[model samples]
Target: PVVAAAPGPKEPKKGQKLSGKIAQIGDNGVFVSFGGRAEAVLDVAEIRGEDGNPTKAVGDDITATVVSVGETVKLTLKGKKTGDIAGLLDAQKSGTPVEGKVTGVNKGGLVVRTLGVRAFCPFSQIDRRYIDNPQEYVGKTLTFVVTTADDKGRNVVLSRRSLLEEEAKGQAEELRQKLEIGQEMSGIVARIRPFGAFVDLGGVDGMVHVSEISHARVNDPNSVLKVGQEVKVRVVKVEDLGGSSERISLSMKQLESDPWETAVDKLTVGEQLEGKVVRVVDFGAFVEISPGVDGLVHVSALAPGRVEHPSEVVSPGDAVTAWVTQLDADKRRISLSLVDPSERSERTPRFDRGDRPPRRRGESNRPPKVHRSGDPSDGLTSMGEAFQRLREQMGE
Candidate 1:
C-alpha cells in the first residue's frame, strides 16, 4: 500500500479571528478545525472559564483569535500574551468583550489585568452607578469592553459599564415589548423620593408618583414605599423618548380595586356617615368616609342657615357626620352636607329666587380691603397683619 502525505494547514495572520469546530482535545491544548486544511491549537489556560473548567469540549464550535501563524496555528481565547497584543486591537475594532481581573484602584480609576497588559477603567466606567467605595471592587474578576486601544495596546481603556448598559438595554427592550398600558406587573422599589418612587420592573425602571401610590392622599412617598419592597403596579403610561430612552408611569392604586366601584353598595343618598375632614378648601371641606374615598361638604351644605364659610363649620382633621345628598358614580363625586338633609329641607329659604339678601353692617359684596400699615382701629398693621385678618375673614 502506498502512503500519501496530508496537505499542510494554511497560514493565518496574527490576531485573525476564526470560528470552527473542535477536532480533538490534547494535554497541551484543544485542536480546532475550520473545515479547511488547518487545525488550530487553543491554549489550555485560555480555554478555561472563571471556574477553571474548559469552556468548550471536542466537537463543539468555538471562536478564537490567531496568536501565531505557522506550521502549527496557535489560538488564544483570553489573548493573555505579549504576542497577543494584536488581538487586543482586533477586539477593540470589533467591540469584543474580554475578561479581566481587577488588580488595584487608583484616584483615576481601576487597574485591570487583561490581554497580558494593565488597562485603565475610569471610575465612572466601573459600574452603572457611582462607586462610593471603590475599594470594594479591588481583587475581583470582571468582564469589560475595550473602549480605547490606542498606542498599539500600550494605552487601553476598558469599560464594564458599557457592557452592563448594553445588557440592560436589551432586557429593557424585551420588557417594553411585553408591557402594555393598564397592565398589572410586579416590581421592586429601587428608590423613594418626596415626589415619587422609582421601581425596577425587571431590568427597566418606572416611576410611581406620590399621587398614584395609594387611594388615600400621600404627603410623602417614603411613608408608603420602602426601598427593595416588592409591589404590584399598573402601567399607566409608556413614552419612548427614542434611542433606548423611556418614561414609564406606574400606579400602585390602579393594581388594587377602585374604591368607587363599591362606593354605591356602601353608601346611600340622604344617609349620614361619620368621616374625618382630610382637607379644607375655600369652597368646601373634603371628608374621608372610607379608605381611598372622599366626599365634598360644600359651604352651602355646612349648616342649616346660610353659612359664610366652611371653616366655621369644620376644619381639617375634624370628625363630623356628613349626610350624603348626591352620589354621581359616573362623575366619581359624592356631595355631602354637615347639616342633616332633613334639617335643610325643614329650614326656610334664605332668599327668594330673584331677591338678594340684605347686606349687614360692615359687610359688603366685595372682599374687605386691608391696607398695610393701617391703624389698629382699622384692624390692619403690617403686611403680615393684613394677611392674617384677610385669612381670618375668609375662614382659612
Candidate 2:
C-alpha cells in the first residue's frame, strides 16, 4: 500500500507564475487565457515591445507572472522578473528615436501609432515647416523623439519636429557646401510668407524672395505662387552671416524670361495698342497691354477733359486704346496717352466750316467773321487807331 500515496490537489495561489495564449488584442489591452478558466487582462503599457509595440499579439503563447489569482488571475509582464515588460519599456525608453506613422489627426495634434504604442504629437512637434493643415500628415511615416511618458504609462508624447530639426541642422551644413550661387535646382514651394516663399530643395530649404517670383514687380508671393507648387529656381545668394543658420536666397525669375526684354520689344514709343486697366492711382492708370507689358497713362493725358484721379476716368478691367507717348527701354517705363486724337475718333474736331475765308496761293483757308470794329460809321477814327482801340476794348 506504500505504492499509492494520495496525490495532493493542485493549489491555486496569487502571485504565481503562469503561461497562456493571447486570446485577443485591442486598443486598450490584450486578453490571455490561463489554464484554469477566465482570461487575464493586460494593459497596453504592460505588453509592449522593445521598440514600444506590443510584445505579445493575438495567438501568441507567452509566459506571464500572476499578480492576483482571484475570480480572475491578473497577470503583468511587468511583475515577472524573467518576462519583464518593464525591460521592454526600459529598452524602448533608452533606444534611439523610432519611426512612427501618423495614424490620426485632430485639432490639438496627430495620433501616432509606433511600436504598438499610441502617442500624441502636438502640432508644434509634427514638422519643421509651418503646417497650415495638419490633417495632411495622416498615413505618413516620420521619425520621432519620445518627449514624455505618463506615470501609469498610458499616455506617451512624441515629437517628430525635434528629430527633423536635428536632422536638418546636419543636412543644412551639407547643403551649404553643395549649394552655390547661380546654381539651378528644382524645388517645391513649402510655405508662402508675406516676404517670400520657402522652397524645399531636396534636404534643405531656400527662400524665393517676393521680388524674385517674377521679373515684374510682385506685390505678394501668395498671389503669384502657392504652397506645394513645383518650380525650378536659381540660387541667387548664399550668405553665411555666421549665425546659428545660413541664409540661402533663391530666385525663380532668374531662371525664367527677363520681362524687361519682352517689355522693351512689345512696348515701344508711338506703339498704339489696346490694354486692360490693371490699376488706377491718383497719378495715373496702369494698363497691361500684354503679359508683363504695362503702360502708365498720366491723369493729365487720360482725357481731353481734366481728371482729378485716374479711377474717375477708368476702373480696373476696362479696355482702353492708348498711345505709347514715351518709352524708356532700359527702365521698362512706357508713358501712355489716352487723349491722343488717333486713339479716339469721337473726340476729334471737324475742320469743315461755311464761314472760312477762301484759300490763297500757298496759304491755307482761315475761318471768317463779321468785322464790327472796322465799319467807318461806327469807329469814326483812323483804321490803325480803330484797330488799336478795338483791341484794347476787347482786352486782346
Candidate 3:
C-alpha cells in the first residue's frame, strides 16, 4: 500500500502577521509556535518594554510580523524598533528614529534612557527653539534620531530637532498647497520679538506684526502674545521671497471689525469728544478718541493761538477735549481743533480773534512807537539811537 505524500515545511508569507504562544526563549532570539514544524524566530531586541529592558517569558502572549521566510520564518515587531545597542547603531547609520524617555536633567543636557542604555541629548538638541525649562521634559517619552553613537552604545547622542526638521521639510509642499490669502488657520505662537510674533502653522512659520496683533495699540508683543500660546490668524499675504524661502503675513486685527468704521459714523463736524494725546509731532498731535481711532490736531489748532510745536501745547498721555472739524472715513483722516476751556462757552475750538499775543520774556513792555501819517518814527528805531536815551541816563 502506497502512503500519502507528506507536505513540506509550511512557510509564512512575507509581511504576514502571526499570533502564537512563546515556544522557547533563547539567548539569540525567541521561538514561537507557527502551527506545524515551521516556527517563528524573532530577535529579542524587537520587543523591549518601555522601561528599557526585555521583560518577556516563555509561553507569554506575543504578536509578531513575518519579515522573511527562509528555512525558518523570520519575524519582527514591525516599523522601527529600538531596544538594544545594535538597534541604536543601526539607527545611527540608517538615520532612522529611536524612542527614548527623558529620565532626568543635568548641567550639560538631558539624561535619556533608551534601548537599555543611557544617552545624552543636549539642550540645544531638544527642540528647534531655545528651551527655558529643561525639567519640563522629564517623564515624557519622545522620538529621537541618533546623531552619534559608539560601538558599545555607551556614548550615544540623539536629537529630536533633526527629526522635526526632516518632518517639516517633508510637509512643506503640503503646507504650500493649503495656504491661501484670507484663509484662517489655528497655530501655536512659536516665538516673540519686538516687532512681531512668529506662529508655527504646522510645518511653516507665519509672522503677525505688532501692528496686526490688535485693534488697540500694542507697544509690546509680549503683553498680548506668549510662546506656545494657541491663536487664530488670517492669512493676509503670501509671497515667494526666493527659492526655498517664502513669506507669510498673518493678522489678528483683520479678524474683527475695524474700530474706525464705527468711530467715523459718530464723529461729525463740530462734535466734541474727549481723548488722550497719544503722539506729538512738530506739525500736530494724535489724540486717540477710541481704542484704535484717533484724529490729528494741527499745530494751529493745538492752542488758542499760534503754537510753535504740538509738544508745547499737548503732550503724550495728556487728557484733553477737542472738536472734530473734519472727518473723512474713506481717507481714515480726522481733523480736530483743541477746545480751550478758557473760551469754550463763548467760541469754538479755534480762538483766532486777531488779538496780539502777550510779549515774550525780556522784551519791551511798551507798545510800538506811534507816529502821524507822515512822521519819521513809524514803528522803526535804530538800536544805537534807541539806546542813546539810556546812555544819557547812565552816562555810559
Candidate 4:
C-alpha cells in the first residue's frame, strides 16, 4: 500500500516580519518557532558579537523578517513588516524612522531591506562624512528615514544621514539650552582639521582652537591630538546661531593651571639655571626654563663680546646655563643672559637699572625689554584668530 505525505503549514511570504522564540540550536543554525508549524532559521553567525558568543539563547524572544521562503524559512533582523508600500508611505509622511538591515554593498551605496522593500541609500547619505568602507555596514541593522518613497520599481530611497542629522540637531539644541559658559566637561575628539580639533560634547561639537590646544606653542594640531582621544575642556564661548543651533568654543589650557601664575616667585633675578634653547628669533633665543615657561636671551647677553645676532651665539636645542637678568611678572617677560660656565659664579648678572648703560635723551630710565611670549600682546593672535580658523575649516 502507498501512503500520501501530509500537507505542512502555509509558507510565510518573503519580507513578512515574524516574532518568535528560539526553540532549538544545532550546527546548521538556530531554529525559531513561529508559535506554529512554520519555523525559520537564523544564521548562527548573525546572532553573535565580536567575542564570538551568541547574543541570543534558547527561548529568547527574537524578531526577524522572512527573507526567503523555502522548505525551511530564513529570517533576518528587518523591521516591522512595513515592507508594504502603504507602511512606507506612512513613515514618509510621519517622519518616523524605520529599521532596516543592510543586505549588501554596491557601487551606488548599500542595498537595504526595509518595510519589505528594497531601497537604495546613496553612499553620501550613508554618513555625515565620506564613507570609505561601506562593507563594514553589511549585515548590520540600522535605522533610517525615508527620503524618497516613490512606488516606481518600488523605488524606496532611504537616508541614515538624515536620521543622524535630525537626532544630532535635537540633541544639540537641548544641550545648548542647558549648557553654561565656563562649564568644564570631558569630550571625545571627533574630527581634526587644519585649524583645530572638533570635540563631541554628547551630541554637539565644540571647537578647541589651535591656540587653545595647550600652553605650549603648537604649530601642528595633528601632532598633539588624535581622533577619539578623550580630553578635558572648559567652555570659553557660546553664541546662538539665531535658532536652535549654536557655536561653542572650548579651551584645553584653560582647564590647566596657567604656568605663569607663579612666574614672579619662581624665576628670581640674578639666579643661574640651565635650560634648553627652544627658539632662535632675530632679537634673541627663547629658552624653556620650565614646562610651558620660556625666557628670552637677548642678543646683547649672548656673550661678553658684541653679538650681531642671537643665533650667532646660541642655536636652537642647545642646552645652556643662563642668568636671569630681568623679570616682569605682570607682562610675563623673563630676560636671561648666557654666561660662560666658568664666570657664572664669579659676578652678579649686570641686569639691574644701576648697571645698565645710560639711556639716551627721551628714553625711559627702565632697562630695555622684549617680550616674545606669555603676554598675548604679540607673537600669536588670540580667540579671534582661533574662531576665524575654525570658520574656515567649517566653510562658514
Candidate 5:
C-alpha cells in the first residue's frame, strides 16, 4: 500500500496563527499552500495597505493572522505587523505643497509634473480669473498644493495659481505703495481699452491715457499700442481723488518730441509746404503739413476755377502741394492757397482799360433817373405821405 506520508506537521488549523512565504500573487488574491488539504487564500487587500497598494510582494515570506476557518481563509498582514515609520515620513512630506511644471493640457484640467509624480489641476483651481487657454500654461512652472492623493487610483490633484496669486497680491501692494508721480519705469501693456492702456509696471499696474499716447490723435488705444509690448512711460499724476482710493496716470507722449514745437520754426507766412489733406468741409479743406500742424485752404483759393465745395477738389488723406498764403501767428492759423500764382498775375495788369472821361467841374455829379416815389402822380407813395396817411387813418 502506498504510504500517504503522515499529514505534514498537521497544518495549522483554521483560526490558528500561520506564517508562510507568498508563492503566487494575482489580481484575486495571494495563494499560500501550507501542506494542508486546502490552500489558504489571502485577499489582495489584506496583503496591501489602506491605499490598496501591496506592502509586500511575491516571494516575501510574511506572517499573517488567521481570521476564519473555511475553504478560503482570510488573513491580515497588517494586524500581525506594526506600523511603518518610513511610510509615515513619506506621507508627511508628500502632503506638503511643491513646485511643478505644466507638461500638458486636457479638457478636464492641466497636467503638471512634480517630484516625479503626475498631478492634475482643474481649471477652476488654476487661477483667480477664468482661463480661456489652458495650453498657455504649458512650459510654465508654478507652485502647487497637494489636494488629493491615492496610490491605488493613481490620482493626484494640484493647484498652483492660487498659491501664486496669494504671493503676488502681497508683493503688488508693497510695490504700489512705492510708486510716485514723475517716476520713470518700464512696463508691459497688459490690456488696451477705449480710454487708455493698463500697463503692468513691475508688480503694480498703471494707466496710460489715450491722450498721453502720442502727438497724433488716437481714436483707439489698441491701434498704436499692443498688449504685451514693453514700453517706457513717465508717471504724470497720482491722485487720491476719492475716499481710500487712488489713480495713476502715465504718459508716453511726454517722452517723445513735441510736434507743435517742432513745426513752429517751419511755420511762417508765404512759406510753401507739401501737405496731406486731412478733412474737407464746405468752407475749406484742412491739410496737415506736419503731425499736429494743419492749415486751411479755402474753397475760394483752391483753384482759379470756382469749386462749390472743398470735397469736390480734394478728399481726405490726399497729398497736395500748396503755398502758405497767410499766417496769423498769435492765433496759430495758417491759410494755404492753390491760386497764389494766379492771384499775383491778376494783380499786375498789363494794360489798364483806357482812361475815364472827365466830369463837369461844378455840376452835381449824379446820374438822373425816374423818381417814382418823389412824384405822387406816378402811383407810388412817398415815405412822408404814407406815414401821414396812416396817422390820419388812426385819428392821431
Candidate 6:
C-alpha cells in the first residue's frame, strides 16, 4: 500500500558478487558487511582447512558470491565449480587453478581443451623448461591456471608453467631441508662442460668438478661423464641462493675409498713391485703402482750409473719392477728405485796419507809399519800421532 513496499532492501541475486569486511566470526559461520547495511553469511566449512581449523578471521576484507538471497544472504567463494565457463571465468578473476588437456601443438604454443572450451598455452607458458619437442605434450592431461578469460569465453589463455613453478618452489624447500653436506645421493648427469659436469639430484642440480669426477686425474669431463648417465655422488657443499635457488658442489671421487690410506700398508719399503710408467719428467718418472697410486723413480736412482733424464730409463707405458725405497705417508709421496738394492755398492772409509803427519825436527821420514789383526791400541796410537802433527802444521 505505501510506496510499493520500499523495494525490500534491493536483494542481491544468486551468483552475484559482493565485496565486504568480515563483520564477525561465529562457531557455525562468518557474517560479512557490504554496502548500505547489506550483510551475508558464509559457511564455516568453506573457510576451514584440512586440519578442521578456520582460515579466516574477523575484520578481513573478503570477496564472495551470493549463493542464495532470502531474508539473509548466503555467500560462497568464487571458482567453486569448474565444469562451466562461469566457473572458469571466476577462476580467472580469482587466480584459481583448473584442469585441461593438451589437444595439439602449434607453432606459437599448445592447444588445450578445458570445459569444452578452446584455450591456447604459449610455448613459454606450457612448462617451466624450454619445450624442445612440443609434440610430446599432445594428448597429455595437465593442470593449469586461467590467466586470461573473456566474458564471452571466446578467447582463453592458460599457463601450466606458473603452476609448475609454484609446485617446484615447495618441493625445493623440502629438498633443501633434507640435503646436508657429506650426504650421498644418486643422480643423472645432465650436462658436461670443460670444467665440470652438472648432475640432476631430484629437482635440483649440483656441479661435479673435473678433478672430482674420479680418483684418477681427469683431463676432460666428457671422457668420464656423459649426458643422461647415472652417477653416485657425495654432497661436498651446499649454498643457498635465496628464493628457491641453490649452488651445490658434488664429488664422485669422495664416494670411493682413498687409495693412499691403504698404499702404505700394502707397499713396504725395500719390496719390489711391478708398475707402469704413467708420466715422465726431467727429474723423475711417475709410475702407477696401484690404481690411483703413483710413485716417483728419480733420474739418479733409475740405475746405478749416472742418468740425465728419466725417459731414457722409463718411457710412458713402460712396465718395470721398482723397489719401494721411501714411503712418505703423510705427504702421499713414494720414492722408487729402478736399480736393484742388491746391486748397490757397500760404502767404505777412504783417507789420504799425504794429508797425515808431517816430519818432526829429529824424527826420520819413513813409512809407518802396518799390522794385520794386531792389538787395537797400536793402530789407535799411530793414528792419534798423525792427527796431532797435522794440527800443529796447520797452525803454522
Q: How accurate is candidate 1 locally (lDDT)?
A: 0.82
The order of the candidates by TM-score, greatest first, is 3, 2, 4, 5, 1, 6
Q: In candidate 3, what residue range of length 10 has the lowest lDDT sum?
A: 45-54
Candidate 5 TM-score over all chains jointly: 0.52
What lDDT is reached at residue 255 by model 4?
Answer: 78
Query: Rank by lDDT, descending?
Result: 3, 1, 6, 4, 2, 5
**RMSD of each candidate relative to the true structure:** 20.2, 10.1, 15.0, 22.1, 13.0, 18.7
Say which prediction, candidate 1 or candidate 6, comes out ahead on TM-score. 1
lDDT of 2 at 260: 65
For 211-255, candidate 3 gives per-residue lDDT tens digits of 999998888999988887889999999999324568999999998
What is the lDDT for 280 in model 4? 95
lDDT of 4 by residue, 112-165 (tens): 877767777899899765565788898888999988886532568899998777
* Collision pairs in model 2: 49-53, 53-115, 53-116
Number of clashes in model 5? 0
Question: Which number leads on lDDT?
Answer: 3
lDDT value, candidate 4, whole model: 0.81
> For every model in order, what is the number of clashing pairs?
0, 3, 0, 3, 0, 0
Task: Write one digit per residue (lDDT tens) for candidate 1, span 1-396.
Answer: 988987776567889888899998876678999865668888665565433346678888888888888788888774455435777788899999988888777679888878776678999898765566777887898999888886445578899988888888788778877889988998888778899999888778899999999988888887777776799999998888234567999999887778889986788898978999999988999999988899998888888776787888888889998898999988899999898766778887666656977778978789877576657786547787667889999995
Tens-digit per-residue lDDT, 51-85, candidate 2: 34577678988777777766766777744323222
In terms of TM-score, how similar is model 2 to the real structure? Answer: 0.60
C-alpha TM-scores of all predictions: 0.48, 0.60, 0.60, 0.53, 0.52, 0.46
Better of 1 and 2 by lDDT: 1
Off by over 4 Å in 5: 1-97, 104-110, 120-140, 145-160, 202-204, 241-245, 279-285, 298-314, 326-335, 338-396
Which is the leading candidate under TM-score?
A: 3
